[model samples]
Target: MRLHEHQAKKVFKDFGISTPEGKVVNDPDDAEKIAEEINSPVVVKAQIQVGSRGKAGGIKFAEDPKDARKKAKEILGKKISGIKVKKVLVEEALNIEKEYYVGFTLDRGSGKPVAIISSRGGVDIEEVAEKTPESIAKEELDPIWPLHDFKARKLAFKGNIRKEAIQEVSRIAQTLYKIFTDKDATLAEINPLVLTEQNQLLAADAVLNIDNNALFKQPELAELREETEEDPLIRKAHEYGFDYVRLDGNVGVVGNGAGLVMTTLDLIDYFGGKPANFLDVGGGAGSATVENALDLVFQDPNVDVVLFNIFGGITKCDEVARGINEAIEGRELPVPLLVRLAGTNYKEGLKVLNDEKLRVVSDLEDAVKEVVKLAGE
Candidate 1:
C-alpha cells in the first residue's frame, strides 16, 4: 500500500518533520482561493501515486494567484502517467540552497532495514548510483536493535553534511525511522529534502509504502490506497483467496506456490515469451480458487496462451484439472492451454484432462518451450 504525497507529508508532520504547508484542491475555484491565501509563489503538483510527475509536466510553479489558477486549470483532469489528476497540492515554493535524499527501506539480502542518504537529490536515486556511486551513503540497521541516535549521526557524517547541521539531520533520520517502524512501512522516502536559504531543512516531496501484511494495524494508511490505479485482477484475486499479480506479457500463468509461479515466469522469459500474470493458488486451494484464477487470466486480452504449472503439495492435481475443464466448458477460450501437473494423483489428473485440447508435458523445461512455441513466441 502506497500513500499519496499529501498523506505521506501528513505522516511526516505527525513526527515533527517540517514540510511545506499545502492545501489539496479538486476544483479551480478552491485552488485560486488557496493560492490567494498563501500569497506567495506556489507550486501546483498533481495528486497521483505514480512517480515522474515533474517529467510528465504535472508540476508547475506559479508566481501569483492568477498564474496558480491558470496552472491548476491546466493540470486538473489532465492525465499523467495514465492516472487522471483529480486534485492538486497548492504549496508555497521554497528557495532551496541545496537538495538531499533520505529513505528507509529493507535490504532484502541482509534481512534488515537500511537507511540511505545522498546529497545529490532532485534526481532519480538509481541514476545517481549509476553515474556517481560515491555520492550516496548507506547504513544497515538491525531490526531487533533499531536505529539509534549515534548511528543516525554517523550516517549524516558519512554523507559529508556540515557539522553544524549534523544534529538536525540526525533528528530527522530518527523521526523517519520511528515512522517507518511504527507504521509497518516497507519504504519511507523524502526526495529533494531541501535546505532553504534560511538554513531550514524541509521535506519537499514524500512517499511511503506500507507493508501489505501489516495493514490491519494501520487503518488510516490503508484508506489512502488508490484503488482505481491498481490492477482489477489483483483485487479480484484477493477476494477469491489467491495470490496474484498482473504483469504485462502474453502468457498467463497459474501455480500452487510463489516459488513455482516465479520459476514459471522466469522460464517463460527465458524461452522468448512474456508472462501476463503471476497467479499462485495457496497450499489448500480448492476448485473455486482455480476457477477464479482461470477467469482472471482469461480476462487479459493480451494472453495468447495459458500455462498451468502445478506441483501438488497439499492440493491434488486431479481437482485442478477438473476445475480447468469446468472453467472452459462454456467459455469462448480463444487461446491454447498448456498444463504440467506433478505430485499427488498424477495419473488420475492426466486422465481428467486427456480429452481436452490441452498439451500435457511432464518435463518443466519442455513444457515451457512447447507453450512458447504454441503461443508463437
Candidate 2:
C-alpha cells in the first residue's frame, strides 16, 4: 500500500530516522496552524499517492503561516496525477548542502532485496538511470541477511556520497533496509536525503510501500491504507478472494494460478495484445469461482475481449466449463469470451462449451493469438 508522505515520515521517525517535522492537515486553516507551530519556512505538500507532486504544483514553499494557508488552499482541492488531494503535509523546510538517495526494494528477477544508493536525489530514479546510469549504485542483498553497515558503506562509497557523510548515510541505509524487511515493504525510499547547512542528514522525503499481501503482519500500516483510492473492481476482487490487478490494456486474462496468469499476460504482451487485468482464481476453483472471475473481468470497461487459461488439476475442467456456460447463459456479456481449457477433462470442457458466443481453443498459444487478433492487437 502507498502511504502519503506524512505517514511515511512517521514510519521513518519510528525507525529512529531523522525527518523534517511535519503534520498532516485536511484544512487550509490547520495547515497554517501546523506551519505556525513549526515557526519556520515550510513546504506545503499535497498528500497524494502518486509522485512528481512538485512538478504538478502539488508542492509549494510557504514564506510564513499566511503563505502556508494560501498554499494549502491551492493544493488541497487540486488534482495531482488524476487523484484528488484530500490533505496536505506542512513540513519544515531545510537548507540543503547536498542530496542523496537510498532505497530498499525487491529485485523480482534476482529474487532478492536490492539496496540502491545515489548521490543524486529529488528526481525520478528511472530518469537518472535512463540518462546517467553510472550515477546509481545497486547491491542485491541476501534475503536472510539483507543489509549490513559494510554493504551500505560499500553502496555509499560506490555512489560517491561525500566522504564525511558516508558513515551516517550508511547507517541510514542500514536502518532503511531494516524498515524494508521489518515492515514487509515492497519499497522503502528516502529521496533527497538532505545534508542540511548544519551538517545534519535528514530524510527530506519518505516513501514506503508495503506489500498488501503482507498487510496481515502490519496492522498499523494497514490502517494507513486509503480504500477510496483503490479501484472498486480491485476491492471487489479482493472481497471475492481473487488475486487481481487492473492493467491498461484491452484483453482481460483469467487463470487458475499466479504463474499461469502471469504467463498468459506475458503471451498477450508477446503477441502485441495489451492485457487489461491479471485475475487469478487460484487452484481448486469451482464452477462458481469461474463465473465470479468472468463477472469480475466483465466489469472492466477497458476489456475488449476476455481470455481464460485454465490448466485443470485439482480444479476439474468440466466444472470450469459449467461455470462458463452458466455465466454466459445468465447474461449477454458485452465482451466476447476466448476460453482455453487444458489438463484434466479438457475434452469435456470443449464439448460443454458449444455455445456460439464462446470461442473455445484447446491450445494456449492459439488461444492467445486468436484473442489478441480479435482484440485488434
Candidate 3:
C-alpha cells in the first residue's frame, strides 16, 4: 500500500519531520486559492503514485495564483504512467542550498531495517547505486534496539554531509526510522531533503509504502490508501480472496503458493516469454476460487496466454481442473490456456481436462514452453 505524497507528508509531520507547506486539491480553483494563500512561487505536482511526474509534464512551477490555476488545469485529468491525476499537491516552492536523500526500508538479505543516505537526491536510488556507489551510506538497524540519534548522526557523517547540516539530517533520519517501524511500513523515503536558504531542512518530497499485512493494526494508514491508484484486477482479486499483482507481459500466471507463482513467473521469463500477472489462489482454493482467478486473469487484455502451475498439496488438482473447465464452458476464450497439475489427484485431474482443444502438460518445463509457443502464435 503506497501513500500519496500528501498522505506521506502528513505522516512525516506527525514524526517531527518537516515538509514544505502544501494542500491537496482536486479542482483548479482550489489549487489557485491555496497558491494565493501561500503567496509565493508554488509547485503544482500531480498526486499519482508512480514516479517521474516531472518528466511526464505532471509537475509545473506556478509563478502566481493565476499561473497555479493554469498549471493545475494542465495536470488534472492527465494520465501519468497510466494513472489519472485526479488531485494535485500545491506547495510553496523552497529555495534550496543543497539536496540529499534519506530513506529507511527492510533489507531482505540482512533481515533487518536499513537506513540509506545519499548526497545525490531527486533521482532514483538505483541510479545512484549504479553510477556512484560511494556517494551513498547504509546502516542496518537492530530489531530490538531503536534507531538512536548518535547512530543516525554517524550515518550522516559517513554520507559526507557537511558538519552544519549533520544534526538536522540525523534528526530527520531518526524520525524516518520511527515512521518506518511505528507505521509497519516497508519503505519510508524523503527524496531531496533540502537545506533552505535560511539553513532549515525540509523534505521536498515524501514516499511511504506500508506492509499490507500490517494494515489491520494501522487503520489510519490503511484509510490513506487511494483505490484509484490500484489496478482494477488487483482490487477485484482482493474481493475474491486471492493475491494478484499486475505486470507488463503477455502470459498470465496462476499457482497455488507465492513461491510457486514466483517460480512460474521466472520460468516464463527464462523461456523467452513475459508474465502478465502474478496470481496466487492460496493453498486451499476451491473450484469457485479458481474460476474467479481465471476470470480475473482474462480481464487483462495484454494476456495472450494463461498458464496454471499447480503443485497442489491442500488444494486438490481435480478441483482446479473442474474450475478451469467450468470457466471456459460457454464463452469463447480468445487466449490459449496451458495447465500443469503434478500433485494431489493428478490422474483424476488430467482425466477431467482431457478435451483435445485444451492443452495439458504434466511437466512444468514442457508446460512453460507450450504456453510461450501459444502466446507467440
Candidate 4:
C-alpha cells in the first residue's frame, strides 16, 4: 500500500523528521485559504499516487492567495496518470540551495534492507543509476542491528553531501531507516531533501509503501489506502477475495495458484497471445469464488478470450466447473472460454463442462494454442 505525499509527510513529522508544513484540500477555495494562512509563496501539488506531477502540469507555484486558487482550479479536475486529482497539497515553497536523495528499501537479492543516498536529487533515482552511478551511495544493513549515526555520516560523505549539511543528512537517513522498520514498510523515500538558503534541512517530498502482508498489523496505516489508485477490475477482484493484476493483453487468465497463473500468462505470450489480466482463485476456491473470478475477467472489454486452468489439490474440480457453468448461465458471454481441469474430482468436473457444451482441453499446451487461435479469429 502506498501513502500520498501529504500522508507520508504527516507520518514523517510524527517521527521527528522536518517537512514543509502543508494542508490537503479538495476545493480550490480551501487551497487559497491555506495559501493565505501560510502568508508566503506556496506550491500547489496534486496528490495523486503516481510521480511526474510537475511534468503532467499537476504542480504549480502561486505568488499569492488568488494565484493559488487559480493553480488549484487548473489541477483539481485534471487526471494525472489516469487518476483524477481529487486533492492537492498546498505548502510553503522553499528556496532550495542544494538537494539530496535518501531512501530505504528491501534488497531481495541480499534479503536485507538497503539504504541509498545520492547527491543528485529531485529526479528519478533510476535515471541517476543509469546515467551517473558514481554519485549514489548504498549500504546494506543488518535487520537485527539499528542504523548507526556514524554509518549514515559515512554514506553522506560518500554521496558528496556538503560538509556543513552532513550531520543533518545523516540524522534524516537514520530517522528514515527507523520509519522503514517501525512501519513494516517496503519503501521509504524522500526526494530532494533540500537545504534552504539559510542552510536548514527539510524533506521536500515524501513517499512510503507499506508491505501488503503487514497491513493487518498496522491498522492506522491500512486506513490510509486510496482505492482510486487501484484499477477498478483489480479492486473488484479483491472484493471477491481473489488475487488479480491487470496486464496489457487480450486473453484473460484464471488459475488456482500464483505459479499456475504466471505460467498461463507466459504460455499465452509464447504462443503469440497476450494476457489481459492475472487472476488467481487460490486454494480451495468454491463455486461462488470461481463465478466471481469469471465475472471480474469478463468486465474487461479488452479480453478476447477467457482461459480457466485449474489443478485442483484442495479445491475440488467439480466445484470449479459448477462455478464456471453458473457464470455462463444467465448472461451472453462476449468471449469464448477454454477450460483445462485436472486433479481431484476431475472426472465429475469434465462431465459438468461437457454437459454444458463448453470447450474443454486435457493438454495445457493445446489449450494455449487453441485459445490463441480462437482469439485471433
Q: TM-score for each prediction?
A: 0.74, 0.74, 0.80, 0.69
The whole-model C-alpha lDDT of candidate 3 against the native structure comes to 0.89
List the pairs of residues colliding in candidate 4: none
lDDT of 2 by residue, 70-133 (tens): 9999998886644678889899999999999999899888899998999988898887887877
Q: State the lDDT of candidate 1 residue by residue for 31-69, as single tens digits.
A: 889989988899999988767889889999999888999
**How far out, in Å, is residue 139 in model 3?**
4.5
Q: Name the candidate, 1 or 4, with the larger TM-score value.
A: 1
Pick the lDDT winner. 4
Instruction: For residue 128, give model 1's deviation from the true position in Å.
Output: 5.9
Question: Where does the lowest 10-residue lDDT sum fall in candidate 1?
Answer: 229-238
Global lDDT scores for all candidate models:
0.85, 0.89, 0.89, 0.90
Q: Give the alpha carbon lDDT tens digit for every residue of 1-377 in model 3.
A: 88989999998998899889889999999999999999999999999776678988999999999999999999999976457889999999999899999999898878999999988888989889889988889988897878898899889988878889888899899888888998999999999899899998999999999999999999998887878676567778888988888777799998999989999998888999989899999997889988998899988888999998899799899988999888888888778888899889988899998466568888998899889888888
What are the RMSD figures for all models against the true structure? 4.6, 4.4, 3.8, 5.3
Instruction: Give lDDT: candidate 4, residue 188.
Output: 98
